[model samples]
Target: MEYLPNIIFAVALIVGIGFFARNVKKLSRNIKLGKDVDVSDNKSQRWKNMAKIALGQTKMVVRPIAGIMHVIVYVGFIIINIEVLEIILDGLLGTHRLFSPLGPVYNFLIGSFEILALLVIVAVVVFWIRRNIIRIQRFIKPEMKGWPKTDGNMILYIEFVLMLLFLTMNATDFQLQRIGAEHYVQAGSFPVSQFIVPLFDGLSESSLIFVERTAWWLHILGILAFLNYLYYSKHLHILLAFPNTYYGKIKPQGQFNNLESVTKEVKLMMDPDADPYAAPVEDDAAEPEKFGASDVMDLNWVQLLNAYTCTECGRCTSECPANQTGKKLSPRKIMMDTRDRLEEVGKIMDANKGEFVPDGKQLLGDYISHEELWACTTCNACVEACPVSIDPLSIIVEMRRYLVMEQSAAPTELNNMMSNIENNGAPWPYNQMDRLNWVNE
Candidate 1:
């Protein structure tokens, strides 16, 4: 019976981690649902990109204040969780302060954790103010209206509560240690939580123990809850940014991926002496009949990865000229819609036992629109602004390719240009006979 608490803790840990793993599996399947493209080149450069962008957070510092605040929350929160390892060990063994034997090292580690936890609290508050009081323009954009807004604030609240619980747990434990209460070891140097210890001064030993136990339980359980919550939150970037950045598009930012099949046909047409029915080149067999992305499956895996990696910070949309000029396209929204549709597809696949039923919906016309896709200047501004190296423009271009190729749905201006190029070898209607008209005039 004495080991019952340990058993319960173990069960809770398993369930929490198990649920997170299941969601991760589902997420992986959804990402792989996107069409394959080789991102295997430039191994060393890819590693450098992952290190600089994801780990070093190189792009985040563009706005120094928010950057510093995010660094505090990000680094502080992550470093503070070093204590979580100890907490887990103690819980599983039914021990109090299991690492107390490490003596001064343990004290320093706990002290650092407490300091980082306090900084995380301050950072989270500033983030809250940015979202609510100051009302950052990006946070208040149209896409941020409903669940996105609520989820943003909800995560902040959760972090605040978790950090508070940690300090409170330490404070109550400190008081118990001062009173020499049983099993409350004299461990951990709580530099920040020490100020909070005096609150429990007048409490009876039993009451102090009760408060300490409650805080401890809540802190650990809350961590577990937050772990699971990541799957449904934008916070998943904390995990995915690594692989996403590694597999990120390394091609020149403004370069569009050409349709090799179309290029081959054009080449053959240009060569009047070439055989029409000759064996297709290497790329022909693997080339998709449909030229561009109409659905999540039509987009390359990297674009889908970009959708999943989006922080939804609106850095992309904020930099977008089309959005500034009041066009309906928001690059952030494009990524979000892609993610949403991918999720919907994933759920359907799972429901139908790993196969998707025809849902009468596609990424191009359904989740994203002609207006949004057309509005993109292919400017690569969103790609440049993204902190995590997500390329919303890539997805935009792929969907646009579908409009021009498969559906013949391009706007009149583009169609006319293409026609001119085809007929007169230029982007003008003048034939070779009239080519010197402008010169004559």
Candidate 2:
């Protein structure tokens, strides 16, 4: 019995550390591949954001059921570590009963943990049903139809099983202690386990011992394996989410990256360069690069990383009015396209062992389409919906800015709108002085 605790602890520690190290390396590689981003600019804002999003879970609460359930499970997981520690101590140290101090307080802790465990199990089961059986529209994709559906479901199931195992193990232990043994009544609470005591009344001493040993091993091993499995799956978010949330963008969603000014020698040849207010170009001899994304390679590292980080939660696509109205634009598709293009180009680049460029065609014209770019209202619904803080609207706006400023190619309506804004201070074709014409004077 004493050897069992040592074995579980040794195996769990080694496996946990090995898995953690391997995942850390993979995460480091992913971070290195990301584009240079400035997330440390506003110290106060970052702290405030962390407090709200991480501690308070402000954004998650928008979906009450899911949010509340997740919050409960998250808190439960953190607090239950103490219980796990106690279990380990009892198994290895021959303590049999743990947390026997502060009679009422200990009982309360046990009771609360038991209730939370039950709740977590229930919540996880509902989550699985929601993702698989209920098949929520927001969770599915047409392209995902043929893919294996077990990854998400499996994680949820593992969590459910772990919680159930914990409860069962604790209940059996509590029953044994109540039968004249020094029960580790750490608190005054134990409602569920107390009720469970009746079931063990008819069992013989040998049967009770077998049940205790089995439940302990199952609960501990199940939890340890689940922890290790987290690194290799989407459940990586369990560790990655905190850092990702802390490093999120602090700027307004609509702002685009500012382009740098050209050199003096090149600036003289262009007429706009001679004017102080005019936009700068690279050089007099340098040909103008086409505006907007030409291909997947043109995306910055952060944009490329965004593709990998997407959980396929479909919040972006669901919030997109274009997708809702039956248009070709799905923000989710845009993300997937970026990922696919990167993989395609990466393959060619690796095969040739050199930088590879696609044959002449532009990404917008060939892959994304001019209509799709024009369809965006810049409403920023996708920006708000993203759980990982990927800013699709910023990408769209940057591309739109490139089209208008560099290519001078925009939709007919946009062209007219720009002309009106340039000459009359508004997109409407009305006199600037008469802007308040509708007001009763």
Candidate 3:
């Protein structure tokens, strides 16, 4: 009973600290990125989004095998907490098995957890083999240079160890019961554990006790450490996935941010003593401000936050036709570049740097090349493929609007296409009058 209370206190303290640290780090990162998320203002909408993406696993289901594996893993993660609860209760009450009173119900839960644990282990092992042995090019590309592969390998190893520990602990517990050291078997039909019990029959009672205790601590502590590690690594998905899914945009995926109206106030600021709604003077003497993203600070906080939330799953890159056809455009690189730019600008902004906009060069000109931007077909393939629902197309279109409308520096082919749209109501070169000629023929 004394040991029970101590164990409960220790586990609670570790869990509390781990949760606090994870949230603090997430909050600090959001602040640094200048994220001003206010989903609270639209509670119903937010809840709907959460229901669709989080509970539904809408984005993950795009790949069936991966999706099924993820579903099992997700459900397992939630249900496995029951084991944690039982551990705490057993430690607190000085009981060999906390659920002894529940009889069949307890057995059912234990059996379910045992099965889920085994399934999760199998699923994760397959995922690891697919990523490493199958050598999915997207997963191991050179661009992931900054990412730590060891982190992924470590997480896989930890999960594997936890699963093994779970099976071993239950098997030993069942063996102890058969030998009459303990009368409680919370789960009666765990086939794996039962099959393994006969082999351990020769072991002494002291050895059995030591093995059970060791497995219990390993399983519990491994889970706790894994929880903490999730927050710091790419596995942050384990925590952030729910919130990220909830806050995802429900608007048309192809829709770009609208430009602010060029009203009287904007005109007055751009040119004094002129009709505010009128276009600004095109005189050579007038200093023309460059359009599009001039630097990282000019980007909206949501776009900046998108960088941190990216799962680096490489789905975007894999689906990019431009990348497939050997163009310089890598959607993955675009995301990484955005993250880097945000970090650099964040540092400068923190130091009270002069301005958000840069002079002489545009974002497309320097950070992401114009060729790369133009190569995008606006097909929404990248958007559709992203596991996190990142809308790269919107960003591309916004920058394109600035290039075409403000700088008038679009490609000659695109310029011709726009002219055709104005002259013929379509991007075809045929004159409107010529439509009658084709009909007559």
Candidate 4:
């Protein structure tokens, strides 16, 4: 029964990791539901983008106040969690302070972890205040009303609690070491937690050990739970940001993707020698091609990746011209709607055993309204504002494509412009021969 604790630790570890892996598989499947596109060009540029944006966080620093605080939380949390390796090793082997053999190096590492843990706690508190108390306009947007608000606060609460548990565990360990308790070693420094050690005074060695064990168990378990919770939270960016930035759009921002079929027809029209009614080859007689995306499946895989990678920080929306002008088009909401619809489709597929069944719902006119879509001016401001390189504008343009080509339901002004362009070779109601009349007037 001495090894029973190790066995239970192993089981918990396996279960946590197992559930996380299952969620990853589901995420990948949903992303792959979109049509494939080649992103293999510019290998060096892609790597540079991933390194600069994802690893270096260059874009995040564009806003100074929030950016610095975010960096502190991000860096401190990551560095503090380095001690999790030590925790896992100790738990598995039933050894206390297994790395203490490293002498002063272990002490230095512990001291650093303690400092970072404190900093992380401070940063988390600031973040909570920014969301709830300060009531940032971006945070209080309509799309952030329900679950999004709750998820944001819940994450902050989790981080705050996890950091507290870390310090509590260290404080109890410090006390146990002072008492020369069994299995406790006089190793590692605790700069911040030393203050916490005073609270453990007058307690028996047995009580100290119990407190230490409880804090230790809770800390590791909480980390595992946070890891698994990423599947449901916008914090999925924690894992996907690297890949999303790597495969992000590399072309010029204003340059749009043209439909190959439409380009082909236009080219033929300009070819003077080409027969207008040429007999079609067997391959050319195939069914007509789809014009644009009416649903998530019609979008490219990279766009789908963009949806899953959205941090929902609302930087995109905050920078959007239309949104700033009180338009219904919130760029953040576009990405959120896409992700929600994709998840809904994925659940339907799961219920049907791997095949997607039509649920009489689609991304357009359902989760995302035409009013919101038409409000966009295609200014690319949102694309530029995304720290992780998410391109919400691409999805908007594609849906607009579906509206114009598939349904011929473009706004009246747009239809009139197209009509004038087709008849007069210009976007005005005048004959091509009378183009010089403008100068005469």
Predicted structure with the largest lDDT when compared to the true one: 4
For each candidate in turn, give its C-alpha RMSD to the true structure in angstroms.
Answer: 2.4, 6.1, 5.8, 1.6
**Total clashes in model 2, counting residue pairs 3 or more apart in sequence or in different chains:** 8
lDDT of 2 by residue, 1-441 (tens): 648767766777677668868756654543444345565577787777767776676777788888898898888888888888877776656565567665677777888888888888888988888888899876676534433246677778788878776766676677666664444343346666666667778876567767877887788777777777764455655555455556666777766566433233355655563666556555644765444455655555566556555555678888999878877777776765555555556546556654565656545565566677778877889978877666676556656766787678888888999899989999989999997878967
Candidate 4: tens digits of C-alpha lDDT, residues 80-137: 7668988998989999888999999999999998898898888888889999999999
Residue pairs with backbone overlap in model 1: none
Badly placed stretches (over 4 Å) of model 4 are: 269-281, 284-286, 436-441
Sequence-dependent TM-score of model 2: 0.72
Clashing pairs in 2: 35-302, 106-186, 106-187, 107-186, 107-187, 107-188, 107-189, 108-187
Winner by TM-score between candidate 4 and candidate 3: 4
Clashes of each: 0, 8, 1, 0
Best candidate, TM-score: 4
What is the TM-score of each predicted model, taking all chains together? Answer: 0.95, 0.72, 0.75, 0.96
For the record, the alpha-carbon RMSD of candidate 1 to the native fold, in angstroms, is 2.4
Q: Rank order by TM-score, top first?
A: 4, 1, 3, 2
Give the distance in Å from residue 66's predicted Cα in candidate 3 to where it truly belongs. Answer: 1.9
Better of 1 and 2 by lDDT: 1
